[model samples]
Target chain A: MFFVKNIRIGFRRHPLFENLSFAELKPGTMATIIGPNGAGKSTLLRTIAGLHPMLSAAGSANKSGKAHPEQPPIITLGEIAIENLSLQQRVKHIGFVPQVLPQASSLSPYEVIFSSIKSVQPDLNREEADQRIEPVFRKLEMDSLAFEPMHTLSGGQRQIVSVAQILVRRPQLLLLDEPTSALDLRWQLKVFEALQDQVKSTGAVCLMVMHDLNLALRVSDYLIALSAGHLLAEGAPVEVITPAIIRQIYGVIGRIETCSQGRPWVIADETV
Target chain B: MLNPPAKQIAGTSTLTNRHQQVVARRVLCVTSLVVAMLFIFLLDLATGASNISFSQVLSGLLNSSELTTPEAVIIWELRLPYSVTALLVGLALGLAGAEMQTALNNPLASPFTLGLSSAATLGASLALAFNWNDIALTTHLIVPLFAFAFAAGATALILFLARVFDARTGTIILFGISLTFGFNAMVALVQYLSDADTVQQIVFWGMGSLARTSWEKIAIIFMVLVICVPASIIQVWRQTMLRCGEEHAKAAGVDVDRLRRTLMLRVSLLSAIAICFVGEIGFIGLVGPHIGRLLVGEDHRFYLPASALSGAVLMLLASLASKTLVAGAILPVGMVTALVGVPLFVLLIFTYARRQP
Candidate 1:
């Protein structure tokens, strides 16, 4: 289990959010953060990834308060505090897929996947790295592009390779920001399924920020909706995707219905 | 969850063979560059002050027993040292260029383009203007010391600006151009204020000739190369990672900022040492890595050696052109490099543009 509590993030001299706390997130499940354009979703994900500096806890906050106000803004993964871990140690447990798709690199998919492990485990030989990467590629059905240059691949193909790169590392927490921004419909489904399978097989936790509301409702086990840097709601998809929350967060007159899987499926009707 | 897709279809044989083929091709590409450099080295030795025939050149090189002969004296003392200096300068510049591009994540970064050479020249002028050798250890060391300090200072200034400006490549180049122009004006100012003999000395040094080349000079450059090249190859992983982009490399556990800083300093050191002896030769550093990237791609394992060889070959050819350009007057090697480098640069642009579409 992991907990994000009392987290405060912002740039120099301005605070974006304070007293941000979330309930414990468990392994073998995924949570999606949904918000409008300036809602600080990406900033929160980057904060969790340690890419942004977070402010210290205030003096009056309580340690054990599960409600929003009492605890310090701290991320504890199991027994270890994330901020206290060394960079290499943090990378061993967390895999991050940033919002931007990197420009075409000269490295082949094989090398790109190999680089993560090789950077940490210098003792791994070429044959050993291949042995580790082959299974992840096979699971994703991306073996054809294994030896091809990453620059030569299409956008969807590179996206799949990026996902495979993360899966191969087997990190305990996977934090993704707009992981499927470049993917087509079919590849988007494929990537979400891969993430689900990885979480299932490895018992890892996934936290994602996505713009697509329907996709978030379809894939996420839990949802956290943000509006103007404040947590509007956090619960199961059915609880968080009500018409009132949709209008409040997205400024959309919307409708929601229970799908066959007993989850809320939402579609915007009109701008309020 | 969706079905996990088919298990596996690739053959182990095909995988192993394909991997071996890539290794073989990289080996072949680097070997060809080495062979080409060797050919140019020999060709360079053949044409000089006294025309030594191909047979005489061969005897002088292979059969050193004929040490007192005229051909041997010309070949051993004059042509060989000059050619070696050209080769070393080219190698250093090319390696430095490749590293600068990789570190800065900008293709336009090179000793010439980024005003590193101009800064070196300015530093050398400072040494000459003040007679820094009196306080410094030796004359030979003082010039390089001042050049390296100035070049490093320029690099640090550029990097600092890059951080402030978010590192738009065009902005960085503009900063470099300003530095180049500023340093060039400073160098000219020093010339204007100095006496005629010192001005003559400075002007002659700026011409970038190989006449100052000696066995000792070649050894000094060789020793610098020995120190610089291995220092680079040791960080081969960092070089390759930086090519993937700085933030991405940093997320993957490489310290991208620190890597760029170290590489910038090392490349400046190489460029400073190179220009301190032979003055400023342009374009080899800019174009050599470009040619290597075209031939071997961006994998630093092959790219580094290929760029170094490409540089040596270009310098050797320029040295020959400097000799053959005029009947008796040896043209400045700098002019010959720009003559060769500009067209090649234009061709590279065309190739890159064509590839984009």
Candidate 2:
């Protein structure tokens, strides 16, 4: 369980989020954050992950401006701070998939995955790390690409490997930034399936920044809509995937239709 | 194990194992390459003027010399320590270059690029100008120490400037160039102040040579190398984390700044020791690590040792080349390194730039 309460964050001379507050993340749930570029969606996630530099308000008039409301401690994975944590500590609990996948110089898929685990379990021998990572590789169907240089992998394959690297650590909090952005139709489905399986088995709280509204609808249990760094809506996917919310948050005219299966999907009209 | 046979072969598990094997083999290749480089260094030191055959040189090296004459003195007392000093300095330069490149995440980073050589030159020049020799140790001890201190100070200043100037790699290099000029001006001022003989000596030293090396000085160089080399080696894995980028390293819970500081100080110290005794040996650091990276594929765990050995080989070959290049007068070994390093570096730059995305 994790809670991100009243976490106001901004960049220098630029306001990203102001007095933004949210609370209580339950285990075995996927919360998809959707927003436009430069809306500070990524910045907000980075702030929560404690990866980005801490941005305090610039001479705010309100007394309660900077304080965070008490809630369950959530693991934050901002790209900047992510690089500062020891490999051991990172692997122990937090699994972060950055937006721009990192290039693994000459490291095999196994070395890359093993490093993630090694960060948490430095005492784990190579054999032990391998044993721990094997299942994750299997879940992602990356067995064929395990020995291949990460450089040789196609975009989707590399993304899968990156996901496996994070998943292998069995982190309590899985923070992924556009993990499936590069995946194709079948692979995207498989990736979501893998995430669902992981959530079911580990009860890990997953918070991901997703661009695809349809994919989020299919994969996420909860939805958090953001517009210009402000929270637009937060609720179950069924309650939150409304055309009004999409218009308000994304500034797009959209229609949400519930198929016969009761799964709501939002379709944005380009001509409108 | 009723697994699909294709799955068994093509599975993530097997691929992961294969990557592990690749890493192992890469490490093995790096180690063997290092050994071969060492042999080349031995040959370089051995095959000089008044050539003592390999057997005699080896026996002299092992202290079982029967040729107790001029040849023995020339081999044991003269060429041996000088060759060892060149090797040590080369090794330091390569390690320093690799560390600087990794820390700054810039391929252009080298001892010369960072202005460490100019700093040492400035320090040594200052010592020459003011006669830090007045403090009275043997010329061998005091001169080297003075140069080392100045170089260290210069290194400190450059690192400080890097932080002050916002730590951009390009900015640091530009600042280093400025510092190099500033140090050069200072050296010039020292020369201007010094009498003719003192200026001559300083200028000659600036040209760079391992000719003046002796066993005592080599011992000091050895101690300095011993301290930094293994310390650097121990941090090799962490250095690899850096190749992924500072953000990645930090997220993995590496104290990026701390790693930079440790590596910077160690590299500067080693490099200062190197040039302090050898008077600014050329281009070994600049070229050595790049060559190592090509061989070992940018993994510092292997790259560091590979660079060190490659550097040693480069210097040794340069030393041997200096001897053969002229009939009687051996060219300054620094000149040889530059002549060799420039063309190789051009090739590296062209190839590296072409391969970039």
Candidate 3:
């Protein structure tokens, strides 16, 4: 199981959220964190990914002058604390895809993914590395564009490449911050399907920070809602996403509607 | 849904074939550049003040004892040192530039971007102005020794600042720019205070030349390249990941901050030794990697050696032009490098642009 306990994250002096703990995430499930703007969704994902630092309880002085817990946050995968693991060990277990797209360059997507895997697993020869990479490209259906330079690829295509890079590593826990932000609707669904397949096949836990609440509700096995440094709700999407909770979190009057396939669909009616 | 087994096999084979073809093409490009560099190296060895023919130079190289004393001295002592220094210096700058650009994440970064060349120039200027040769045991070596010391000092300072400031790419670049400007000003002040002959000597050094190289200097530079190039090649995968972006590299488990620091140290060592031995050979560090990137893309496995070979060839050709461009008066190799490299670089860029559909 993946778990975060009493995590507080923010910039140096200002704490965005404190004493935030969530442990409902289990293996072989896709979880999505959804919130309004500045709700610390990405920051939370980054903290779990080890890209951002978790604040000490005695972080910095705040205007309210409230003392937090003295201990640092504990993030664990299975039984091991993430902070206690070495960099190589952490990478082998956790994969993170940041929100930003990669810079344009002469490197092809194939080269980027191949090199990414080789860098982490340097003992793997070319054939072994190629064996790992070809399947990902085929699964993602990016085989034709594999050799094209990154600069020539579209933003959505590059986003897929970024996802593909992390997937090839086959980490036990995947953390992606808005992985589908740049993708079109079809590509976004394809990426979701790919993530689902990965979770089902490998029993990996995938946590993604998503902007589109409707899509998150439609696809995620588990849903987390945050608002103003608070966990507004967390559970199965059908149980967690209600009109009242949506209004409280997003400050918009939203209705929960069921799709033809019996998935929850969020319909924003108007600003509250 | 997956493809059928037969089609999947076919697709895999096609990808393997395409990848092999790409690797083969890059290997061919690097091999051709090495061949060109060798040809220019021979040409450089043959063309000098002494009236040695290409065949004579080859025979002399093959059998040193068969040649007369004067011929041996001319070939072994003078021409051989000059040509080898040019080749090694070219290799150093090109490799340094490629690493620097990747580490700094800036396309325009070169070996001199960190101000090592300017620091060397300042050192040479101070040695010239103060006439340090009078106190030194080896008169001819005083200036280069001073230059090397100052360049190494500057490198240490940069590394120290990088460590203190967390080695952010933007902060390192800003510090490097400041160092370059500060060193250039110091060089100017020393130049202004020096006597006319001292000023002339400093100016010549600033223009740079391979004329003053010796066997010892060539060996020193060769040793440095030997150690640094392989060290760099070992990090080829990490460096290639860096070319994608720092964040990407970091996510791939690379310690970006540590990688930057190590890369800076290697680049500083290569360029410091190179610039100290031969005044300030510009253009090679800046353009060699560009030519290499155009020839073989950013895969550092191919790109690094390609950059080194490109630099070696450019330097050898420039050294040859410096010797033969005028009658009996060899121009400074530094000046010839820009003159020879600019047109060729421009043509390469145009061709690359045209080929990109």
Candidate 4:
């Protein structure tokens, strides 16, 4: 399970999120955090990944200069406190996919993925490393594109390569920031299906920050909606993505309709 | 459920074969570069003013006791030290340049981007202008000593600033550029204040030459390369990870800041040692890695060694040209480096452009 409790994150003077907490997400569950712009969605994901700083109870004083009585924030994966683990230990269990794509270079996707594995597990021989990487490329359908230089790959292709880089590690908790932002509809569906299969097979938890609510509704097992640093709603996709919550989160008049597969689909008509 | 699809199996086999082919091609490219570098080293040894034949050069190398006195003296005393110095300096600069570019995440960055060469120039300028050779105790060693000290001092300052400010790659690069300009201006001021003879000497030193090297200097540089190259080799995976991006490297548990700092220190040491002796040989550090990348992509295992060999080859070719360009009067090797390197670099770029889709 993965959870964060009373995690206040952002600048010291003006905390973006104060006393914010997330409910427990069990292993094998795929969850999405959906929000409008400036909702601290990416910041929250970064904090959980141990990339961004979270303010402590002692450091987060109110405007009137009194410290809150709350304890320091606690983030745990399974039974271990994430902050207590060393960086090497933390990365073995948690993988973070940042929003930015990999830079264009002469390196091929195969080299990048190979080196990523070798960087952490230097003891693995070339054949052992190849055994780990071959299936990932095959599963992602990127085998043909694996040997091409990164600069020649499309943005969506590069994004897939970035995803493959992390997936090869097989982390227990995968935190992805907008992994499918640059992907087309077909690729997006393929990526979602891949993530679903990965979660099912490995019993890993995936938490993604997603902007496309329809896609989120179609794929996510659970949803958490954030608006202006506040949790608007959190529950099953059908229950949390109602018209009222849409208005509160995006200030738009949205209606949730059932798709052919009986999943909720969100459509926005006008700004509130 | 018992068997996989035939098409899937076929695809897997093809992928494995193609991967093996790619690895084989890279290995062949590196091997070819090593052969070319050895040929150039022999050519450099044979091309001095004494008109030594390639056979004679080989004989002198294989069995020095059989050579005439003058031939032995020329081969053992002058050409050997000069040629070895060029080779080692090239190796050092090439490795330093590759690391600097990766550490800064900028393709245009070279070992000199951190201002080591400019600082060395300022030190040499100061030594020439103030007549530090007049001091009896230091005598012959004053100029190189001063150049080395200033270069090291500049690196120490950059590292100190990086630590104090917790600076990232961009900030570190900015500090290095500022130091380059500052050191260049200081060198110019010293040149303006000096006498014509001193100014001329400084200019000649700045143009760089391997004519003055001794075996002791060669030994120092070789020892440094022996220590630094293996250090770089062990970090090939980490450095290749860095090529993806700093965020990716950090996410993979690499301490990017620490890696950058360590690489900078090694680059500074390598370039400082080379520049203090050779004055300011250019182009090899900047272009060697680019050529290496074109030959064998950025897998540092191949890339690093390829860069080092390419640099040594380039330096040897430049050294040969320096001796032969003006018949009897040897031009500075620095003057010949760009003359030899630019055309080859342009050709490689064109070849790479044609090959890329």
Compare the candidates by DockQ and give the number of the best one. 3
Task: Determine which window of 10 residues in candidate 1 chain B has minimal summed lDDT.
Answer: B1-10
Clashing pairs in 4: none
| Model 4 spans with C-alpha error above 4 angstroms | A60-70, B1-12, B133-140
Candidate 3 Cα misplacement greater than 4 A, ranges: A57-72, B1-13, B133-139
How big an interface RMSD has model 3?
Answer: 4.8
Candidate 3: tens digits of C-alpha lDDT, residues A15-130: 78877887657889899888888888888876776666666664444522454546556888877798556555677788889888987888888889888888888888988787
List native contact recovery per candidate, as a fraction of 1: 0.28, 0.35, 0.58, 0.55
Off by over 4 Å in 2: A11-20, A53-91, A104-108, A138-158, A259-262, A270-272, B1-13, B69-72, B129-143, B184-203, B341-357
Error of 4 at A171 (Å): 1.0
Candidate 3 chain A — worst ten consecutive residues by lDDT sum?
A58-67
Window of ten residues with lowest summed lDDT in model 3 chain B: B1-10
What TM-score does prediction 3 earn? Answer: 0.94
Q: What DockQ class does candidate 3 belong to? A: acceptable
Q: Rank the candidates by TM-score, best first.
A: 4, 3, 1, 2
Q: Predictions ranked by lDDT, top down? A: 4, 3, 1, 2
lDDT of each: 0.78, 0.73, 0.86, 0.86
What is each candidate's DockQ, to 2 decimals? 0.33, 0.32, 0.45, 0.42
Q: Which runs in model 1 stand beyond 4 Å of their true positions?
A: A58-73, A139-154, A259-263, B1-17, B53-63, B69-72, B125-146, B159-171, B191-204, B341-357
Give one digit per residue, the lDDT tens place, for model 4 in B1-357.
112133366645655566777899899999999899888888888888887798998988999987899999999999988899999999999989989999999988898888889999998888778775465433247788889999999999999999999998888889999999999999889988888988898899899899758888899899999899889987888899888888878777777878898899999999999989889988899999998998899999999999988999999999988988898888999989999999989999998787655
